[model samples]
Target chain A: MDISNLLKICIKALLNNKMRCFLTMLGIIIGVASVIAMLAIGNGSKQSIRAEIGSMGSNMIMISPGNGRFGGVRQSGSSMQTLKLSDYESIVRQASYIDKITPTVQSSGQAVKGAKNTPTSIYGVNEQYLDIRGYEIASGSCFTESDILHANKVCIVGQTVVNELFSDGTDPLGQTIRFGKIPMKIIGVLASKGYNSMGQDQDDLLIAPYTTVQKRVLAINYIQGITASALSEEYTDQAIDEITKILQTNHNIRIGQDNDFNVRSQQEMMETMSSVMDMLTVLLAAVAGISLIVGGIGIMNIMYVSVTERTREIGLRMSIGAKGRQILLQFLIESIIISVAGGLIGVVLGVAAAKIIALFGTPTAVSTFSIVLSFLVCVFTGVFFGWYPARKAAGLNPIDALRYE
Target chain B: MNEIIRLEQIKREFIVGEEVVRALRGVSFTITQGEFVTIMGTSGSGKSTLLNILGCLDVATSGEYYLDGVSVRQMSKNDRATLRNRKIGFIFQNYNLLPKTTSIENVELPLMYNRHVSHSERRERAIAALKEVGLGDRLTHRSNQLSGGQMQRVAIARALVNDPVIILADEATGNLDTRTSYEVLALFQRLHRDGRTILFVTHNPELASFSSRTITLRDGRITSDIRNDRIASAAEVLAAMPKEEEE
Candidate 1:
């Protein structure tokens, strides 16, 4: 028999039992819908995290002091004080991939401006710190290079600091805010960055020239850390490598010796986070795959019942001239039609579900790859599960089947 | 006349729980084209088994059973199926018309298995066959909507639509009233008169008079095979009977 006629016969048979066919398709529908929705949710979270990391800075590399050994006991990384202004200068002057570099020192203190007072961390950095950290000035100008040379007491205040130290109606630019008995003039207001992934407030900080904070507040000659930005995100690894080589030679560290400084790139963090997200997405898809198998079993069960119930019909068809393979093909086509149709409907339902999830403020990304993959899986499920029942039908003896009233 | 069927020492056996029950015991027969023959027997007499073998639904255990000069015993299962499709048509006792299907579509069933038949040709042949069986006006009526006699006529149309070499009917009117049975038998007589080969199997001895030849089976063997010179005309009997009120 031709494929068109076979399809017609299968369709007619299915339509004769409309309710049963629809119920049989329900399992597949739910399976595919959940698969798509789960993967979308997983992919959406991954995208959001990547965007968050991107906002921090894609090409930014940080050089911090490594752990120090005192009395044969290892101290924390921050307490080492191994990074210095000279090391930062050597990197700035020697590294070819470096775009912008800055030395940083940090201290926590209370900022008091007349009646308003708030506790916040004060960061000492040059103007390049804003470029490396992807920060923009909201209002007022940043301090100049001359400010660092003169050791001027000018700072940039974040939005949270502005809100805390100044009244709602008062202007904050050029306002002098005292930091633990040291008053500094506010040169600019940094752009408002809402929060990090960890729910920490990002805009509650202050920025000043490193020389001023090192000389006046902290009273230290060595810098705490250095931040640098590469020419582009692709050059981050090369920039880190060049900075490490320059630092190693400047510190006179020979080969095979542990360096006193650590270079970390945001790109590395992005790759690690991406891999974790990929794993989570695969895990979710695997869980959803279990439901698909259950759905396939449902198809198998129904097909077996249908073959048993239609034994006489099979006999009649065989008597008329239907070959065994023709009967097998007929049943197989029926199952495939059911699953593929269910898969298409499930795709629509899943996309709608994703949109509904997005409305609830969770990110959802629907990828074409997942849709196509699920469709292929549905086809395979139909073939794999429909095999046994169709074979049983085809192998039936016509004489016995006809007598199977 | 061309010999349409030749069965030589055909035997069939069944292994029924340690007992080898013989269904056919070396029965031999030959049927020619344009012959109307009847094989009559009671239950357990192997007439059903004979009809199954003749219809190509079952293979004989040991025999050279030739259908239209081709040895069916040597044919593959699929080849036998093709031969059945090309050469034989069957009318069952229950009519076996697919319920909830229209008369024309039921008639189109056999042709659907013929790959050489185009879609339009199938419909046209089905319509022509139905018209031949006096069901031209009820082409779209579902089997359930038709009377018993009408349903049997639809089955006859299905058997005729394939243009096979012979029609094998197993107790074709076993489910009908005497009046309806005579009506269907009259149609078969008409087809037989039109030079169609037909093999009719039935337990009713009264139906034997409607065929030109009658064979009797007893104990898995042919008890008698005789030609009838005084065959009764079903159309004449149906016409002479009293007419009943239509429902």
Candidate 2:
């Protein structure tokens, strides 16, 4: 028989038992919908994570003073002071992959202004620190080359620092706030950066020229670390390589000896985060896949029952010159129609569910691959689950089937 | 009359769990075209077995059975199904119309299995057959909505749609009341007058009086075959019977 004729017959039979057909399709519907939605949520979160990491100075590199230990003595990068201003200057002059550079020295202390005090860390950096570290100034201007040359006590404060040190909501620009007895004039107020992905408050810091912190606050000659931004994200690795070569040669550390400073880039962190997200997406999709499999089983189950229930119908068709293969094809076509129809509805519902989830502020991305996969899977499930029962119907003796009550 | 069926010692056996139950021991008969023949027998007299064999639903274990000059005894199941599709129509006792399906669709069923029939042609044939069975106005009525006699007419229309050489009906009137049964029998008589070959299987001896010929079976074998010199008209009998009580 031709497909369309067979299709009409099967459709008529399914419609004769509409409730049974719909219940059978429900399994595949839920299965496919969940699979699509799960994959979308997973992929969505993965992309958002990448965007979040990219927001945090995606091409920025940091040269710390040390790598935790040297000669069995615990030497932290924050306190080692192996990084120097000369090394930073050498990289700025020689490195071609990086477009911006900054020398940084941090000192933590309680800032006081008219008896209202709050503890905050002060980072000493050059004019390019704001651009390199993804910081934007809300008011006033950045510290200039002239300010660093004279070691000016001018600084930029974050929103949290402003909230803590200033009692009233008055303009703190050009006003001096003391960081442990050293009164520094506020040149600019850094824009608010609510929080990072790690749940760390980003708007809780102070910035000044490295020269001032080095000479006046810490009384130190060597700088703590160096931070810089590559010309673009793609040049991050090359920029790190250039910085390492410049630092290694400047420190006069031989090839066999470990360099006293460590060079790191945001690209490394991005790769690690991406791998974790990929794993999570796969996990969610797999969990949703289980539902699809269960749906297939449900289809198989109903097909068997339908075969049993329609034994007399099978006999009638057989008596009317329907061969075993025709009967099998008819039943098989019925199941496939059920699953394919359910699959179509599922794709629509899944996209809708994902969109609904997106409305709640959760990221969701529906890929064509997921929809296609769901379709193919539901079809396969129909065939896989539908075969045995159809065969059972085909193998029946026409006489016995007709004689069946 | 052209020969439509030729049986040569047809035998069928069944192994009922270590017991050999011979359903049709040695049945031999020949039927020509345009004959309204009834095979009458009691339950367990192998009448059902003979009907199944005639419809090509079951193959005989031994002996030869030719249907419309085609060798059917040794034919494979699929080949027999094809022969049944092309040369035979079946009307069951239950009517067996697919529930919730329109009468026209039910009549269109047998034609669906034949690849030679196109969609529009199938519909045309189904409508024509239904109208032939006096169900022209009930073409779109679902199977459940039709009465017992109407359902049997739909079944008869379905059987005739494929233009089969012979129609095989097994206890077709068993499910109906006297009035409905006579109405269906009258319809069959009209088809017989139109030269349609028909085989009616039933246990009712009274049904044999309406047909032009009668065959009696007992103990899985044919006991008697007789050609009626005087055929009782089902239309006259139905007209003379008391009218049905309308609800």
Best by lDDT: 1
Model 2, C-alpha of A392: deviation from truth (Å): 2.2
Task: Write model 2 residue lDDT over A11-93, tens digit each, in one string.
Answer: 88899889989988998899899999999998888787777777778998988987646679987667686777888889989
Q: How far is A66's C-alpha from truth in model 2 (Å)?
A: 5.1
Model 2 ranges off by over 4 Å: A65-99, A107-121, A136-141, A157-180, A188-195, A200-204, A217-222, A230-262, B16-20, B73-76
Q: What is candidate 1's local distance difference test score?
A: 0.91
Look at candidate 1 and tell me the lDDT of residue A247.
90
lDDT (0 to 1) per candidate: 0.91, 0.90
lDDT of 2 by residue, B155-218 (tens): 9999999998999999999999988899999999999999999999999999999999999999
lDDT for B24 (candidate 1): 96
Classify candidate 1 by CAPRI docking class: medium
Per-residue lDDT tens digits of candidate 1, residues B67-119?
A: 99999987899998898888998898887777678999889998999999999
Please identify model 1 stretches exceeding 4 Å from their true place. Answer: A67-75, A93-97, A108-120, A159-171, A178-182, A191-196, A215-222, A241-261, B15-20, B144-149, B177-179, B233-247
Task: Give TM-scores for every candidate, taking all chains together and pairing residue i with residue i.
Answer: 0.91, 0.89
Per residue, candidate 1 scores C-alpha lDDT tens digits across A41-124 of 999988988988899899999899887687899889888878889998888788899999899999999999998899998899
Error of 1 at A263 (Å): 2.8
